[model samples]
Target: MNNQNVFYDELCLSIYTTNRYFHQLYQIVLGKYELTYLQYMVLLNIKQQGKSTLVVICRNLDLDTNTLTPVVKKLMIKNWIKREKSVTDGRSFELFLTNSAEQKFELIQIEIARIQEKLVGDDQQQFTKILSQTHTLNNRVQELIDELTNKK
Candidate 1:
C-alpha cells in the first residue's frame, strides 16, 4: 500500500479501537444510573444549557434529531429530563434536567474524574496532547462531512 493509504488505515483503526474502549468504560460507569453514553451526553447538554429546545441541544451536540429522539425518550422515562412545549414557540419542545438528573450528573462527574485519573495516571502532558489532537481531528471530520454533504 502507498504511504497515504497506510496512514489512513492506521488512523481509522486507532480511532475505532479507542472509541470502542472508551465506550465500554462509559457503559460500565453509566450503567449505575441506567444511562448509555448518548443519554448522558444529552443530559449533559441540557444541564449546561440550563433549559433549551431540542433543536438547540441537537445543534450544540452536533447530533441529528433522529439519533437524539430515542435517547430523549429514555431520559424522559427515567425522569431525568422533561420536555415541555416552548413558551415562545409552542411548536418546539424544550428540554430541562430534572433535580434527580442534576444530582446524578454531579455524581457522574466525580466518578468520571476518578476513572480518568486512574486511566490517565500522571500523564498530564500526554493527556493534554491527546485532547488537543482530538479537538483538531473532530473539527477536520466535521469539515470533511460538510464537504461531502455539500457535494450531494
Candidate 2:
C-alpha cells in the first residue's frame, strides 16, 4: 500500500484504540460513584446547562429521549439529580443537580484532573489543538456518513 493509505489505516486504529482506552479509564474512575461514562456525560451536560429539560439534553448530548430518559430516571433514584416542574411549561420538568451531586463532583474532579495531567503533561497548548482538530474531524466524518447514507 502507499504511504498515504498506510497512514490512514494507522490513524483509524489509533483513534479507535484511544477512544476505547479512555472509555475504560473513565469507567474505572467512575466506578466508585456507580456511574457509567454516559451517565457521567449526562451529569456534565446537566451541570453545564444549569437548568435543562429532556429535549435540551437530548439535543446537546445527541441522544434521543428513549435513550436518555432511563439514565435521568436512574440519576434521580441515585439522588444525584432532581426534577422540578417547569414554571413556563407545566407539561415538562427541569433537571437540576442536587447537593449530593455538587459534593461528589469535587471528589470526582480530583481524579479527572489527575488523568488530564497525565494526558497533557506540560503540553496544554498541544492538547487544546488536538481537541479542536478532533472536533473538526468528527464533523467531517459525520458529513461523510450522511453522504454515504444518502447515496445508498
Candidate 3:
C-alpha cells in the first residue's frame, strides 16, 4: 500500500482508540455520580442552556426523544434535575438544575477540566489548532451522516 493509505489506516485506528479511551475515562469520572457519559452530557447541555425543553436537548445532543427521555427521567429521579411546566406551553416541560445538582456540578466541572487538560497537553497554540480542526471534523461527520441517513 502507498504511504498515504498507510497513514490513513493509522489515523482511523488512532481516532477509534482515542474515542474509546475518552469514553472509558468519562465513565470512570461519572460513575461517582451514578451517571453514564451520555447522561452527563445531557446534564451539561441542560446546564449550558440554563433551562431547556426535551426537544431542544434532543436536538443539541443529536438524539431522538425516545433515546433522551429515559436519561432525563433518570436524572429527575436522582434529584439532580427537575422538570417544570413551560410558561409558554403548558403541555411541554422544561428542564432545570436542582440545588443538589448545582453543588455536585462544581466538583464535577473541576474534575472534568483536569481530565481535559491532561488529555490535551498544555500547549495553547496546539489546543487552538485542535479546536479548529475538531469543528471542521464535526461538520464533515454531520454532513456524511445526513447524506447516509437521507439515502436510507
Say which candidate scores most in lDDT: 2
Cα lDDT of model 2 by residue, 1-152, tens digit: 89999999999999999999999988878999999888898888888888889999999888899999999999999999999999999999999899989889778888998998898899999989999999999998988988989942
For each candidate in turn, give its C-alpha RMSD to the true structure in angstroms. 2.0, 2.3, 2.3
Ranking of all predicted structures according to lDDT, beginning with the best and ending with the worst = 2, 3, 1
Angstrom error of the Cα, residue 40, model 3: value is 0.6
Off by over 4 Å in 3: 1-6
lDDT of 1 by residue, 58-77 (tens): 88888898988888988899
Cα deviation of 36, candidate 3, in Å: 0.9
| Worst 10-residue lDDT window, candidate 1 | 52-61
lDDT of each: 0.88, 0.91, 0.89
Misplaced by over 4 Å in model 1 are: none
Q: Count the backbone clashes (under 3 Å) in each candidate.
A: 0, 0, 0
What local lDDT does model 3 show for residue 138?
82
Error of 3 at 42 (Å): 0.8
Q: What does the lDDT come to for candidate 3?
A: 0.89
